[model samples]
Target: MNRRGFMKLMGSGAGLAAGSAIMGSTLVQNAMAAAPRRGGTIKLAWVDAVDTLDPHFTASLGSVKILNNIFNGLLKVAYDGKKVSFVPDLAETWEMPDDKTHVFTLRRGVKFHNGDPCDAAAVKWSLDRVKDPAVSSPHAWKFETLAGIDIVDESTIRMRFSKPYAFLPVALTGSTGRAGTIVSKRAVEQHGKAFGRNPVGTGPFKFAGWRENESITLERNPDYFEPGLPYLDGVKILLIKEPTAAVAAMMSGQVYGMSLSPFQFIPQLKANKNLKVYGEVEGNYSFVGMNNRRAPFDDPMMRKAVAAAIDRNTIVKQGYFGEAIPAYSCISPPMTGFYDKNIGNSGRGQRFDLKKAMEYRKQSKYQGEVNPVYIVAQGFTGSGGSGTRNSQLLLPMLEKIGIKPKIELLDRAVWTKRRNGGDFDMYDEAWIADLDPDETIYPEWHSGKPWNFVGYSNKEFDKLLSEAQDTLNQATRKKLYD
Candidate 1:
């Protein structure tokens, strides 16, 4: 419900009394009721599964959104869904006179769920802990790349960057990827390895319990700073990794919500009058990532040929729901500044050109039989259908261009091991975009910089990226990025 409407309903005793009468009614019915209900479990299923509850250690949408209730960053993007703009969260206000330095004034009267006072020292402790080399948090990359964070006072913090990085503000949204969520130092030191299971933050909800991969439950913090908010008494996240079953659970009212289902289900789900479907264009790109350290793809000409021959538009039209945009380049569309204009709109070079692809391949030095491997995980074995799709349709297309990729399917257990061990030529992969442009590209393409899975890098590309980060002027930065 909108804030104004909710306030109007809550203003009257009659509306609140009426709402109390409908506590056990259906959610949709309650939504239509004039007053907000105070208690119920919000069951949600996520597309990606969460492995750890430690806020700083992982970068997945499932874990981050769940933690949104349990942790508060120094600053956060307003929930209005406009361009990402920072607003107060733990910090009441912040200022930056130059591109390299920033100062933040913390909000007072805020306490962790465990009742520890949240002061500047707590903020500094959280920030400093993330940069520890032993910790190497998935979200720690945000703090480690900076020059340093200096604690100014019990309610203030000053940050200095080694270089002029423009994406700092956007990074402090929460504890996932670029988002940096604040943690209570006392809680961590007290709990040690058990902290992930029992986190303490100054957010709307407090940790209740976690049942491994089964479910995670949370309770509302009675001392929540925002009065009359969070509405629900608790949130329960069920780790149902299978997307199809997740959709079914939502439809049956076994769960309140879930991430998207197969593209084909959108129309059917929309037709259900009892359900509400929400959507927005996202910064996600799925592709066949080639192992640049391997034989055929190790040849840049062959890589170029594969890039040239793939019919990306056709892939979008047939393989995925018509929802997907054709992508040839690495950057996804939602990332505003980093898209290279020279690269095709889909982010790759261009549409299929068999002649050019063959020419590039013939120009390469390798003449032996070329075999590429496409690896897929086989572990979504429960309610969803088989984990693998038919690769037969792709063979004809590749045969016409004189390329063959032998398909390999591994169980989830083996796939995890093989992936980290670098066991295959190519693997189907997906990358969710960070709030800033630099976070989207740096970890993927910068050579010798870890997370560069493709093993492809260029000195010129690194120079451009370095220049883009330091250029404060937006236009100049875009030019340098280009």
Candidate 2:
């Protein structure tokens, strides 16, 4: 097919992306919405599967986004994805008394969904529970710098860091994947391992029920700390895995709002007059993380071959349809001060070259005799008249370098299980809502870290990253990262 023909096909196949866009039709139009409509149920859908509601355990981006709505942290990130800024949530007011100590005054009368007091004690317990090894919080690494929590009074608590950690406030945000989202101590201890299923929090919404593989129902917190808020009686999030099916539901008005709408549907959705679409440059990055412990990929030459074969510029223009920026560095373009414009050229990073990829493949252990590895994408199929457009972009490029792939569009839970167990080869996925440069790369690439899904470990890289995190000076940190 011609390039235009190929891009046209790919656009229709845009698959799962976390917090991609929210589209609303009749579901959002309220005549009295001007006067604050109070009783309408906002129906929304998620294209990815959600296994757990417990914020601390599941690393799934879908679950995290859902949890963000049902829970509140001491602070919150700027709602718009334009910049990184911290705003208060559960904490009514807070002050950093020193470089290492953070003092917070809790809002009185705040209560969990179960009517339990969400006080300073609860905050301390929640933070302590995350750090507790017995809890096995997957996000524990985000709080490694936490020294201890000291409850000053019934409505006040102080948190101390071991060092001058500038990322502390950002990490404590109420956004997805953040460490500061506080849960009720009573609810957690009462439910134990089942707490994930029955989540209790002090937010606008409360977990009503989950139908597993179908939908999650949330009801408004009648006694929410924020007065006259939430604006809706409840929210119902449908779990629709297929992209086109979701688009059909949205167009038919079966669902009022939808997130992770396939990029291919953007043009079509925009053409509809009744719907309003809100989009932002996602605070995330998608990638195919290889299981480096396995053969073929274990050889650096084969890995370099995989990296050099694909044209990133075309992927952004044709595959993403100009909806995304071509990212060479993990820190995306919106992060102005840290993002480097000089990194994406022939002299520095890997450039698209089929010849270079073939040459690298010839020098590898497999030497062009490697078995076709499985490239698993979550929540969508490749060629079966359904799935993500990612295959349209990646498949032919890899073929040029003689790395033919068998694409598997597995269910989200199964896909996550395989990747976490090292039972998969290459997983197509993204880590979203991340802000810090350290958080984005360190957890996923650092040696033996909780999120090092690829089992990659380089001592020098680790050292440099550590220095970057420790060095307070921005210029010095950039130099260390370089």
Which candidate number would show the highest TM-score if scored against the true structure?
2
- lDDT tens digits, residue span 47-72, model 1: 55565567876555456667778998
Give the C-alpha miss distance for residue 85 in model 1, angstroms.
2.3
The regions of model 2 sitting more than 4 angstroms off are 1-36, 79-82, 333-337, 341-350, 362-365, 381-388
Q: How far does residue 264 in candidate 2 sit from its true spot (Å)?
A: 1.9
Best by lDDT: 2
The number of residue pairs in model 1 that clash at the backbone is: 5
Q: If candidate 2 were superposed on the true structure by all CA atoms, what would the RMSD be?
A: 7.1
Evaluate all candidate structures by whole-model CA lDDT and list the values in order: 0.63, 0.68
Q: Kindly state the number of residue pairs that clash in model 2.
A: 1
